[model samples]
Target: MTHFAPVEPDTATGESADLLTQVKKSLGAVPNMTKGMANSPTLLKSFLALSGAVGSGTLPAAVRERLAISTAQLNGCEYCLSAHTMIGANVAKIDGEELDGARRGESSDAHIAAVLQLSNTIAENAGDVDEADIETALEAGVTEEEIGEVVANLALNVMTNYFNVLARTENEFPVVSL
Candidate 1:
C-alpha cells in the first residue's frame, strides 16, 4: 500500500493537472510514479526539468539508461529498475546482455563499464568516491564531460529512486525486484 496515494490526473486541478496531462501526452501514459509525484506540482516539474536537461547531455541514450539501471540496482529501487529496464531495451535498444550487465554495474564496452563503475561507486558511497574512482574512469576513455553527465544522470535517477521508495509508488510496469 502507498503511504501517499497517487493524485489521479482527472481529479487533479491547476498545475498538477496540467503537468500530468503533459506527461500523458508525451509518454502516452502517466506512470504511477508521476501520478504520486503529481501531488506536488513543483516536485513533478522539477523532476521533469532535470530529466529533460540530463536527457540532452553528452551521454548517449543507451549510456544514460545503463547508468540509471546501475544506480537503481545499487539503490535497490525496484520501480526504477523495472522502468529503466523496459526503457533501456525498448527505447535505447540496449541488448539483453548489456541490460543485465548494467544491473550488475558491468558492461562489455570498456567506456560504459567505467562509467557504470563510477556511478555505482558514487551511489554506494553517497557521492564520496575517492580519486582512484575518477582515475579509473578516465583511464577507460570516459571523457570529463561524460563523467560530469554521469553525475547529473546519477542525481536524476537517485531522485526518482528515493521518491518511488518513499512513496511506495505502485509499480505499473512489469515488476522487477532486486
Candidate 2:
C-alpha cells in the first residue's frame, strides 16, 4: 500500500498539474514515481532540474543507468531497480548480462566496473570515500569529471530510491527483484 498516494495528473492543479504535464510531455508517459513526487512540486522540480543537469554531464547514458541499477540494488529500492532495469535494457541498449552485472557493481568493461565500484563505495560510506577509493578509480581511468558526475548521479538515484521507498510507490514497470 502507498503511504503517500500519487497526485493524479488530471485532478492536480497549480504547480503540481503543470509539472506533471511537463513530465508527461517530455517522457511520453508520467511514471508513477514522478506522479508520487508531483505531490511536492518543489521536490519534483528539483529532481527534474538535477536530472537534466546530470543527463548532460560527461557520463554516458549506459553508465548512468548502470550506476542507478547498482545503487538501487544496494539500497533495496525495488521501484528504482525495476524502472532502471527496463530503461537500462530498452533505452540504454544495455544487454542482459551487463544489466545483471550492474546489480552487483560488476562490468566486463573495466572502466565501467571501476565507476560502479566507486559509486557503491560512496553510497555505502555515505560519501565519505577515503583517498584509496579515489586512487583506485583514477588508476582505472576514471576521470575527475567522471568521478564528479558519478557522485551527482549517485545522489540523484539515492534521492529517488529513498522517495519511492518512503512513498511506497507502486512499481509500474516489469518487476525486477533485488
TM-score of each: 0.96, 0.98
Off by over 4 Å in 2: none
Tens digits of per-residue lDDT for model 2, 30-67: 99999999989888998999899999998999999999
What lDDT, from 0 to 1, does candidate 1 have?
Answer: 0.91
Error of 1 at 34 (Å): 0.4
The digit string of per-residue lDDT tens for model 1 on 19-66 reads: 999999888999999999998888899899999999898899999999
Count of clashing residue pairs in every prediction: 0, 0
Off by over 4 Å in 1: none
Worst 10 residues of 2 by lDDT: 1-10
- lDDT score, candidate 1, position 119: 88
TM-score top scorer: 2
